[model samples]
Target: MRKQPPTYSPQMTRMAFAASFAFAITAPAHAQSTVTLYGIIDEGVNYTSNVQTSAGHGHNLYSISSGILSGSRWGLRGVEDLGGGMKAVFVLENGFDVTNGKLGQGSLEFGRQAYVGLSTPFGAVMMGRQYDPVVDYVHPLMPSALFSGSIGAHPADLDNLNNANRINNSVKYRSANYGGFSGEGLYSFGGTPGSVGTNQIWSVGFGYSSGPLNLGAGYLVARNPNVSFFGTAVGATAASNNFGSSPVINGYASAQSQRIFGAGATYAIGRATLGAIYSNTQFRHLSGAISPLNPAGVEGTATFNSIEADFQYQFTPALSLGVAYNYTAGNNANDAKYHQGSIGADYAVSKRTDFYLIGVLQHASGIDSTGHAARAALNGLTPSASNQQAAVRIAIRHKF
Candidate 1:
């Protein structure tokens, strides 16, 4: 009788204790969430010699440059759980010029990244201004990782395939990582009313990384990329031709749109990494007046074939050295040829900081136009001004 009385309520007693423990454990997790504020601030001094000014003047100029090592920016990112396997996610990022406190995202404050979406085991779908999949997946695997950008980046970063920039009014999709292989696709709403057919772009890209090998490929086609780089626009006319806000009078006029598709890969062995990339870019539907010296209305199609090889080695955990060689050949519709070569290096001061050095050498042959020298001088700059130029930059970058 005594033993039975003591055991009578054992199940009820255990249930009461379990409820108290669960309440204590879940109270904090339910009452509070986490938000992270992060950003990067990078700036430095840049020196370029033989900076071609006007039609026939080369001047050595020293100035403060923004984003030589990394673009300056600040952003907010957050997450909240909705229970089960679902969650709410959002990010708002703004790019700025550290030297002048100017907004980096065109005229929009949040031009760098502004998006909200749902994330799950299947994948993620996001909307707003965003980075093209090609830049996100492909450029990171190239020598540009150490050089800060691809040598193949087009004039004024007019296109994203080389990771020059991002686009507006876009929706993006990213697949969850599957054993180091993932894919992404993006569609950018041209946002130009009746001009829809002539002012839009679309892209798709993929990446696979396993062990010491990494590979990426992507394709991009724009209806009128040349218009922005070669056309005359307000505000641009006032700035230096190097900036390309307008078309210069007495200057060469070249209207050509482009389509680029290519693949790149990298291999890591021991303390060194080796990288290579091949890109094919074509310019079509060309029409423009050559330099005033010869305004016979120049028109020609151009094809560019570029190949690059790069190497990086860690001298120590904090000290590393990198070198890259890039070679490119341009064949115009008339089969005129232009060739360019480039090399560069970088050093890491810490996980979130670094310094860099780079040089480019270019030579063109078989072009028959007064603009040929101007084109070479421009080094493909939007306004095109260098017959031959060299740049050496030193910068410091910090991330939080």
Candidate 2:
């Protein structure tokens, strides 16, 4: 060495540099971390045969709408490998009105979902604002997800199958799939000083899927429906947020607590799939101040029972048709009944683009939450002035 190290050949030096560069690039790939950006946009024109006008009169209306087949949303999701069959994961999703370019979900950014947690071989545990167990494990089996989107949801989305609300300050756990079965649980804090349970929410759900059959069941309970489910502040007399404002359940907005239980199943046969769902919703400790539907300013309770059946057929790899029927009955505060029918068709333009048309019909009978004759109302639309309502929509959707 003292005699001067033999000069390294230029070729040897170049080879050494290439080897180090390759190692640097290959090492990161082995960790298996990834981040993805994704989104869906749905825009449409809607026609309603009966819609409440500014003067509280029913009138035909035409307007632009967003989120027919699916809510327009954009999100970022990421996972970082932590070794030993574990990973760190996070998701942030935002909902918006495509027509007006305004934020949805109470105008909060990332209002649809925001969570971070660890995923392991055994399960996943996340904490933040997120969908409850019912929405995660059970809602997907409902017609609302399979047929016509929000228009096909249960009356008032009483069972939350439409995911009208997202829990805040929450902790959730999802079990790893065991063969064809999985389970989920969630708890949301009230975040109220001195009252840990005043506005809390809790839910549990289980699901099973094997081949062409799928089944799901879930239960959810929310204390202080106005404050907890609607994201209103404590002591708010009326609902501050518009979540779950459908005429079918609006009168019960002041309920002290709310509970929902639901179950659903779907089976595939050839090119068609058949599904059925049932849900029971209860509103407790209602007062006249909260809803005029209560018995003459007196305290009372309310309940709704709903059932739905649906079918979907794939005419071809790029085209599909669907039909659904729903029945809902309300008791306690007011005796009301609702019947709804929905039909839809979709054609795929590409893997990421599609066109769709949907129609819905509804009829209502008996007393309503306003203490007046019940009015027909389709989900996501204004209540009809009378007992019957009809709606139709044509739309284009794109995903990326």
lDDT of each candidate versus the true structure: 0.60, 0.85
RMSD of 1: 9.6
TM-score of each: 0.76, 0.90
Worst 10 contiguous positions by lDDT, candidate 1? 242-251
Candidate 2 regions with alpha-carbon error over 4 angstroms: 1-30, 232-245, 290-298
User: Model 1: what TM-score?
Assistant: 0.76
TM-score leader: 2
How high is the lDDT of residue 284 in model 1? 60
Q: RMSD of each candidate? A: 9.6, 4.8
Pairs of colliding residues, candidate 1: 232-247, 236-245, 301-333, 377-385, 377-386, 377-387, 378-384, 378-385, 378-386
